[model samples]
Target chain A: MSLASAPPVRARAVLPGFRLTFGTTLLYLTVIVLIPIIALVIEGAGIGPARLWDIVSAPRTRAALRITITAAAVATVINAVYGLLMAWVLVRYRFPGRGLLDALMDIPFALPTAVAGLSLTALYSANGWFGAVLAPMGIQVVYTLGGIILAMSFTSIPFVVRAVQPVLEKLDPALEEAASSLGASGWTTFRRVIFPAIMPAWLGGVTTSFARSLGEFGAVVFIAGNLPFKTEIASLLAYIRLEEYDYEGAAAVALVLMVLALVLLFLSNLVQIRAARYGAVTA
Target chain B: MTRALLIGLAVVTTAIFVVVPLVYIFVQALGAGWSAYAANIMHPLTLHAIWMTTLVAVIVVPVTVAFGIGAAWLLSKFQFRGRGLLITLIELPFSISPIIAGICYLLLYGRQGWLGGFLARHDLDVLFALPGIVMVTMFVTTPFVVREVLPLMQAQGSDQEQAAVTLGASGWQLFRRVTLPNIRWALLYGAVLATARAVGEYGGVAIVSGSIRGKTNTLPLHVELLFNDLNAAGAFAAATVLTMIALVVLVAKTVLEHRR
Candidate 1:
């Protein structure tokens, strides 16, 4: 029987310095990133299933996880609806300050998380400007679950906005025209045509925003009020564990957060791929 | 009317959530006027943190760029064994939390760490020192450059370089003349993003730095420390520096996008 032939090896581009550069990249990656992550996984696994269960199932740990998951879900839901609207506005409508608004979208990406937290806290605090307005309406945002979601949304707004904007911009105008010709109302057209076209990308963006909110520390810590079993989050709790010299406990907490982030990243990729599949011709 | 209301909602949400906080930082920093703001920034500890932050950037940016460029060259230019695995491995850092990265290093270098015994025997410090801070910063920002440059190079493919090589150009000549110029914008864009990150990183540096004032404290850490001490003025002033960096990054990004 004839065996199947293997493919030929690809040629090296930087043949002159290939070995040197490749070696340096591998060594640097191993030392700077790979080794430490491996160390964390090792330490986490060494805790064994029983210890891991005990640490995470504890009242405090469970509370932080619950709060973190709930807040992130709320934030993602807010982003899902709001980001769609924002992207539609930016792409479909021509406004006076459109370019300026577009530039402001990147602010969240550039601004340091700690700064975002501080600014949001200032704006939402009782004596702060927005708080003053909202308080008269009997709404208190700061030092509450509302404040946590606000900060997360502030830091992660760009994700959903930027993700959906391009898709909306590149949308086939012919489809909208055809719908109008078919006597579809504006709302009906949006419901049947626009929403379905952009849903996967929109979902992908929200998933990313959700994942980001989970690992958020600087912004959340400042505004979350840090009251255990109430405002405290998983990342902050993990930080506290580290501070207490409970390394194993900290690693356990972090492993759960890492898993959550990885899951979201996986979901984001799947959603993006689904988006691609849905619009093979248009996308 | 629906469009107006929706746009109004978007505008209001951004104004409340995005714009207000940005303006609030400078407003608070200058709450005591300009002179006080300057003094807060010029405080010795603040000075040290700024310098420390700059030092970390100077060291980390180059190393990260080298990693980015090197990795870009290796994984893209040549098809190699385990290339897919290598890419996933390179990208692993982005999925990790900065705090977790610090924890990993701490477990590897802290007083009771794996290397702790050897370091103590050698009288060398790793955790809670400048070295530890640099390491963590490098780890956090490692993926930025690769993420930026690799796609461009791959899309361009090896056709140009193969032509140059066939024309009797040396490897350096091929890279310097053909590759570098082609990838310059993407490379600089990556480096700029990395610089912003290296300067702004807080959580990773905080855990490894031990928060020793004027010694290992970074700019972001200094801002948090000042706030915690009720030194609101000092905190705001220092935050101004970081915000300005963020502003510059935004401007640079705009310019880059316009060029593209």
Candidate 2:
């Protein structure tokens, strides 16, 4: 009976044809992704070790790195709290113009970096609208660290909100209701429950925003005035290096930026993995 | 109660910082009288910049979408050794600063680049050429469609594909009949996003583009050139057009999201 009546049942034993797909994927990525990155390393190799050392150790490169890291860190920290709140508002409230506010989160994503830079500079420049008010307070923005932070933060905000918004939407409302029902206050419930669930996403957003801010060039250049040893970013320095045809120097600095970006993305992936694992455990 | 306050603060901050500046650019651009606006908008360079930008988008959007579909199909449907690493690598461009992306292509195809001299000896000029600009823009915009489409493909199971296979569907038939229908919306969404980004891309393209007026200068670069030339009104006018496209993207994304 088993032989005569049994239906074809090798499906479980025979997995889908993943081998073909995987091979194609590998080839595609190798062509598009690995080769370019490897080419960078190879081109960088021609410069040799001592020159690489000099490139990374140069005062200007150091200054650029410092500016990049400082501005990125400050922008990330600012957005971490604010981004979460923005996500929370979009998810929790039904206020007037909510759709407009929600749509606004993506403005940074679509706006050209150069245009954003110019507009931000216009708004914050001494002769610009906001600058008029800021200047009277003796708080200069154009060509300063403050302006860089503002511009970077502007471009990087969506990374945080977009990352966190989905998590916020999926959060269980009944959990909050249950906590309140059980006599737990709103603050306590959030601290104990909501925060734990959203913290990982929030962290992911921060890391992404930080990485974006670190690599930002267009928006920062327009407003920062590209002053060396002051507002110049790692990216701008790399650009300047290219402008001067310092190819080796530019590659060296770019390699450093690439490594830093890789580290941040690695960390972000780690957090995402942990978040998924934790979600599974809790579920 | 405190949560409400927190939400309010977030909404307000995002609106003020992210939204206002975007809207303000266009408003300021249009602040001039209609006669001045007509004159500003009708400049030969303005038309040329728009045409160049559209040409770049027309070429870039299709090639990118194709690359994205192929890459996304492979990533979503396949499970193999180094799959995670490959996926991570595919996204590296998105994370790496665009400035670095420009440098990467320059290293590969610039005048003194690895293949640069090889191509040059063959009379091929990539850098400071339209081919160079499009290639760099393609690099920057590659991740957009794949990022959008791949996740949705993953979430929607492959049972329909299996069913088609059981029904004796060829690879093309299965993809066209089963996979394409499920992913069409996602594909369109991704294409739109990629187009918007490509149109607005400045950092990488600016590097490789050489910004020769009426030749390689894209709209965004043109705006920068105008601004630098201290023709603030002209820069603002061009920027306003870019902002209008951005607004359309915003509305499109919102509508698409709501439909989803």
Candidate 3:
């Protein structure tokens, strides 16, 4: 029982097979993920920073990055607001088909991105269902950044809903009651008492969806029409660069996507910690 | 009332964005009549696509499951240096664009790649081939099982297992009789999600698959190919298969979440 007694065999992890499993996990991760990423990074770096800058700073690459970031941001902002609305509706309201709506939130999580892309294109094309309605107003979605935003939003839909739903559902009803009793309208009660409570969670969800939409590919490609200097996106551009045997081009393009991913993940983690702190205070 | 108005907007948005796309796939799938749908399903290349997709899943799910369980057990049970970094690294794939993952494999294994000469000298192919697709798919879907199972294991604590060990339960016995049953649902959930992503993978597979039609095209890629070839009915028909899978996964997820 003494501290000098070989740490009492173990502090935790009473199970056996730790070493074997740990080694295998590391090996699998290295082969499957680490090596490939390192190769890509090395390839990108091998091009020299000067050449790398030249490739990435080209007008074509700049436009792709701008379009990708812009569309992803637009989609994320929409989903963030819409997601709060959707989560609130699902959590606060009781109506027929409620359970169905709740379960249906994960449709984007389950649906193939390519399928989503195809169907979205069909639904928004000039002769298609909603497209027919918007076309008369001289509004075009497909082959434009609007289509890109739509595809990104569609695939990233589940993140915001899933993230904020549980938090909203778990909010104390008494908070709303107190706010209302204090001469608050429904909107005011929400803004004052409810909004701050859910703000961190909402931000977390929005950042996550933003991150997802940023890297989105399959769905985006189909609807984007892949028009260079216009509808082209970074991920799609990376693919095209690889296809054209421009390995350096592809690596540079992918490196940007990778950097964006790391940044978004960092941001998501920050929001999560803040959200957790807020949650503790509210609770 | 604004209440009704707000809810109505949510409903309409969901209907258009979520419900319609789902409904559209099925309707277009069946648009070509029952016979056309059946023929598309029965088409040899379509069948091959299904087989290839299934093969990838079949290989990936179990390997990932094993890796997931092993990693989760090691990770959740014991504290070690660099644990946080290891976790972040495992989760790195989730946020990385899958297309980038594919480009990575292509860079390492493609004919012009660094290892290309060695692979070619060995007469081994890993790029624009089955092995390449498998590797990239594995990379992209890597975190699903671990992400699902790790938290479950962590929250479970080691109390029960510790008690079992003191009572003279062997490692194998403890795992089989205690640990396995506890995490079974989460494990299954992880497998299902991983399988879903694996089957539906398009970006990474699209890169390494070379879109070799009958040779390497998975179902998602095949759908893209069909659409590209102006075969709308065929594309929809193929997409219907994926939609059905999505529905099944949704049901499973809801059931699992309810249990939780």
Scored by TM-score, the top model is 3
Query: What value does the lDDT take at residue A110 in candidate 3?
Result: 95
RMSD of 1: 3.9
lDDT of 3 by residue, A1-283 (tens): 0011111123354567778777998999999989999999999889999999998999999999999999999999989988988998898888888899888788998999999999999889987888999999999999999999999999999888878887887888888888899899988988888888877778878877988898999999889999998999999988888878899999999998899888977887777776665552343
Winning candidate number (DockQ): 3
Q: Model 3's DockQ?
A: 0.58
Q: Sorted on TM-score, highest at the top, how do the candidates line up?
A: 3, 1, 2
Worst 10 residues of 2 chain B by lDDT: B78-87
Segments of candidate 2 deviating more than 4 angstroms: A1-32, A280-283, B1-8
TM-score list, all predictions: 0.95, 0.92, 0.96
Q: Quote model 2's TM-score.
A: 0.92
Give each model's whole-structure lDDT.
0.84, 0.81, 0.87
Clashing pairs in 2: none
Q: What is the per-residue lDDT of model 1 for residues A141-250, given as tens digits with 9 covering 90 to 100? A: 88899999988877788778888888888888888899999999999999999888877778878888898888888888878889999999988888899899999999
**Model 2, span B38-73: residue lDDT tens:** 777789998899899999999999987877777666
Tell me the lDDT of candidate 3.
0.87
